[model samples]
Target chain A: MGKHIRTVNANQAILRSTLQGRGCGECQASCQSACKTSCTVGNQVCLKEKKQ
Target chain B: MIHKFIFDDTRMVFDVHSGALHIVDELIWDLLEAYGALPEEELAQSLSGKYLEEDISEALEEIKELTDKNILFSPDPLGGAYKPPGESVVKALCLHLAHDCNLSCRYCFAGQGKFGGAPGLMTAEVGRKALEFLVNSSGERHHLEVDFFGGEPLLNFDVLRMLVDYGRSLGREKGKEIKFTVTTNAILLDGRIGDFLNKNDISVILSIDGRQGVHDAMRPFRDRKGSYDVVVKNIKSFLESRDYRDYYVRGTYTALNTDFSCDVEHLASLGFDNISLEPVVAGEKDHYSLRDSMFSQISSEYEKLTRSILKMTKEGRHINFFHFNIDFEGGPCLPKRMSGCGAGHQYLAVDPPGTLYPCHQFVGREEFVLGDVFTGVRRGDLTRLFRNSHLYRKEGCGQCWAKFHCSGGCHANAVIHNGSIEKPYSPGCLLAKKRLECAMYLAQWKNAPDKS
Candidate 1:
């Protein structure tokens, strides 16, 4: 009941710019900037979850 | 790529995409790593100088075996494309019996049972319509489940009773196994109610957090009094009529109780054999919310709980922890999976007035309302959204070592935590990975047989 796919794609683009610039690079190999939790740098969980 | 982690004596590698797990010895591990970089001939040459031909070939055989399973495969730069969710039959329906709750818990996700709407109870007419909807929409699935859900389903005990009778009658006529389940706070449970539940063979999910202080601190009556004493008394009374094995003691751990293993211990001490602990879902500002800082502590507590279970298991008492019994083979196979639980696809929740929802979590949210019972289902818009919300459609799930197993985790939590269902809640995402790792560790170290 929502036109979310297009908005999601657009938001993702903006999020990518903001998060990546702030060092919160995308972790999932499946999608760009897919993880939304504020996992700080050097967090082991984020490190392990990142693409190998 | 397979993420490999080596322990003291064993090597574990997870193929996130294919949903395969590989646990090998040091030699086979070396072989797999070497093969990833070198061709078979070159790989053999590289490892041949250090090992015997037979041993190397055995390792090669292992690789070949893994290759057959797609656990080991050549990488192609060509990536995947979004595949819409296949038409899946509805096998389970959650019936929200009451929109009002007696306990106004601090972290109540449903806003104290009314969800976001005014307090109300479902009518028998609505319940009958919901049952009809489930039977109509469930396709040809011979096994169907109906869960009596609520702020406190007991609040609408009459409707629930009539619905169960109606469901049983319908099941007999249609030749479907209509299993019923109820998730309750146990406050309204009494001797007569318990007997009815057992006689009707209705499975119950009892909510009892743990020790008095902790349970009462989070969950309190509408009168602003602690509910621990009343809940425990009611739980014990309920079990007297029903077999304890037919129910699960479900608890939610908040930030206040990060050391939650003690809660499990308390439940176990009370002679409850089945237990499950879920983390509270709340905004970061909420005092009881599980924040980023508590992830490690909570994860460690789970580890402790696992150790305790192992000890109990060795002592000849087996306790059922819901996640530990997760059988991937018995679960949805790789091809049939979408991201997170198959909400809206394989499962649907019906609200008080017969409004259909994706699942119980989205019961009150207007944005997530798929449709109401009167108009059948508003399939086009919501269906396409859920169809496209598959793991493969999301670019972020690729190469995650836990992807196939986690299936990108829960959609509701993603939407709640990250402001979008398209994203992953990192804390939960990380905890799941940790849990999988723990489950794997326990299986191998305990010499547990392949339950898969």
Candidate 2:
């Protein structure tokens, strides 16, 4: 039972890393962080969070 | 899990799983808050249709990324949020060390060029308090620069030393650096004084109009004796010292000595790197105003001066035309929000008596007083001056192309000439444009081949 649980935790860790990578890769590059591009007006339209 | 919070017109989204908070773009957050009940899929499709020509699948994928970062959050009929280069960052503080002077130069702006209206020096108590106020008021993580000025800063040696020591101590305590400079007459600069200045990293700007005849004609002692010899002797000694190579001494020339071509060369030969020539401020007597002919003559003399400096610079020398040109993009000189002059906004000058004027140039007039320094720096009156002062936002100046560069000239000069700060600063603005144009012409000429 202990061995099985350890294997499941390892698989979950790998799955989490994959999801994080995909999520970060798809976000708009121009809006690195919100504060950095706040002065620009068009940066608002590029915001992906609002689209969803 | 994603959590969203909004404050101060900013939105922050936090990811519980990653312990990371991502701030959303200001505009996007505002749009989201405006459109209250849009489903994520429908919103994504609409965004794709309206803005991007890309497929909805790609847009949805991008939205998922933002959602994962916690920068985007869904509303449970509750709430959600997020979000916020450099031109010239020149910050300068003109510190008035003493309201008194030892020698009365004929054209002193501080009214100290004469003996009558000179006030006493700043006490140690006042100096300490002022330094504390300056240090505390300035935000953390910004460069602090102090420029020592007065009728003459050297006359009040005790207070100067106290202020310097205080600055050094505060710098050490806060892990911040402070730079010091002084504008003075070369008459008081001896070998010992030069050594002390070099040790303390203080740059000296000496006022010497031109050669013996011209300098003496403009800047004479109270007893009317020529001070050229004394000042020259001091300059010679200071420049000949062992550490002279490291010392920075710039010559400041007034407009009265326009006829002295030889004097300009003399200054260059005296080992001065930078030279600043300024037009004499208008006074009660019509002593300094140039006639059309005289102005032409002065312009010719300036051309010669520029040639001399350019020649030296070619031979690995450096020179600066003080009023005409400044290296705005090169270094951090003063705290200017935009690439413009500081008047009525970034900084204000307060006199020894604690009266707040727009700048150092208008310290004497009562009508120009915004408030007393003792009360003004803490209150809202300083901001009010920006709104009410004509000099701050003149209609003509606002529409002018030179607005970004000159900021409509100094507020003090405007108030003095027009009797109201709201009027256009025509004199200074016209002079500044002429000077800049002349500098540009000279620069072009320097780069051109010798036609002769």
Candidate 3:
């Protein structure tokens, strides 16, 4: 919403959805790309838009 | 928002916005969230279902008492705009004296000591201007702190001596007390260096990463040799200088040493009293980085170290850990914070050739450069960007319970790991919360009644 921004859907951001049922359901996905960052048990993965 | 940590009989509630603390029962805690939303009559009716009418009234009164203090129902939930301590005095200045180091620390934030740029030393002319900037900008401040920092500040000891002399003379003229501190690895510290430090009234902070094996593995010579023996030997010599009681022996811990309680214990055995251990900051994929898997290991070690410190204290030993000595009760009253350290406003970092950044972590980062020493601070787009980069403006931090304590967290690290200064690194937040809890427990332990 600031300027020159892109929003991604759940399907776009999440890659190799976990078998543990921790899908990116209600979670907001700001990036629409193959996940270079892993979806760990701890919230260390960068699921949101990459910051400056 | 209140982040409550459960102890034994009571829970410690920390108000993230104001840093206010409240210890309350389960009933009062539950009503804190539900009571604020409804009208008094409706709230009383709703709460009557769970308790007697008299109990409901008492609960409402309690909520009103806290609400009056602006703790529970804060008008500015995001902790109003960042306040710059009234005046624009240059109270503290960190001078990047040497942008090169003899040791290649794996977690060196300044890019292997050269700052990801050409290796160079701060010239005498530049150092003189830095002093002038500090004295001129320090308005009405009697005490100003000047820190000599870098890959190794001891690299250019000549310029350091000259600057100290000039700064002292200027201090007397301005009726100010200029305190000088240098952060070094102690590899270059010799008899001459030690004598110069004491003679010029310059205090030194020696960096030695815990035990021999862990330190040598993490911090190695440029040629990849162990530097533990040399550093320890020089540290002993450096302490022999005049008035040496006022220095901190700082160390950093990484994945290489998950059993870092041993490091703290090792430092105590080495006869260093004032000791502080820091968690190493490294990239996520960097194998030596502290990962989710290492949390339990680190946590257990931290607990062990805390117990050991209490044992040592009981034995009449003066050894101390920096993490446990913090006073959560003494932090700033809510409403005047954006970032972790007072970066843009109160503090500023200066690299060679006179470029100004908010702090030392972002020294080599050009995009974050505020301005140079000559042109003064450029209050335009960059300034706005830096000022706006607080907890209130940060995305995830707005709802955080540790918001004020961390203040949107470290800007450089957020950008480096998450890709934006607008984002708060969750790992850093977890670390801060865990450490704060430990600090609190230690404080409570110190004030505990004698069960004996």
Which TM-score values does chain B get in all models?
0.88, 0.68, 0.83
The candidate that achieves the highest TM-score relative to the unseen native structure: 1
Residue B184 of model 1 has an lDDT of 88
lDDT of 2 by residue, A1-52 (tens): 1110111111121112322212111112111111110111111121222334
Error of 1 at A6 (Å): 47
lDDT: worst 10-residue window of model 3 chain B: B331-340
CAPRI band of model 1?
Answer: incorrect
Whole-model lDDT, candidate 3? Answer: 0.65
Categorize the docking of model 2.
incorrect
CAPRI quality level assigned to candidate 3 from its DockQ score: incorrect
Candidate 3 chain A worst ten-residue window by lDDT: A30-39
Write down the TM-score of model 1's second chain. 0.88
Superposed Cα deviation of residue B451, candidate 3 (Å): 6.1
How do the residues B154-266 of candidate 2 rate in per-residue lDDT, one tens digit apiece? 87776777788888998788665666667777767876677777778776666776677777776777677888899878876876764454333333334566655566567
Error of 2 at B254 (Å): 5.9
- lDDT per residue for candidate 1 within B1-452, as digits (tens), equals 66676543456765544434456666666776767678888888887778887778766776776556444552312245445435655666778899999898878888888888988899999998888777777677666778888788998999999999999898888767677888889888888788889888888888888988999988999888999999988898788666575788888888999888899889988888887777777888888888898888988887788778777877878777655543322233333333345566656788898898877877888888888766777865775676568776554877576665566667677778787767878888777776676666555545434322
Stretches off by above 4 angstroms in model 3 are A1-52, B7-11, B15-89, B199-201, B240-244, B329-339
Off by over 4 Å in 1: A1-52, B6-10, B16-20, B26-35, B38-65, B68-89, B328-330, B445-452
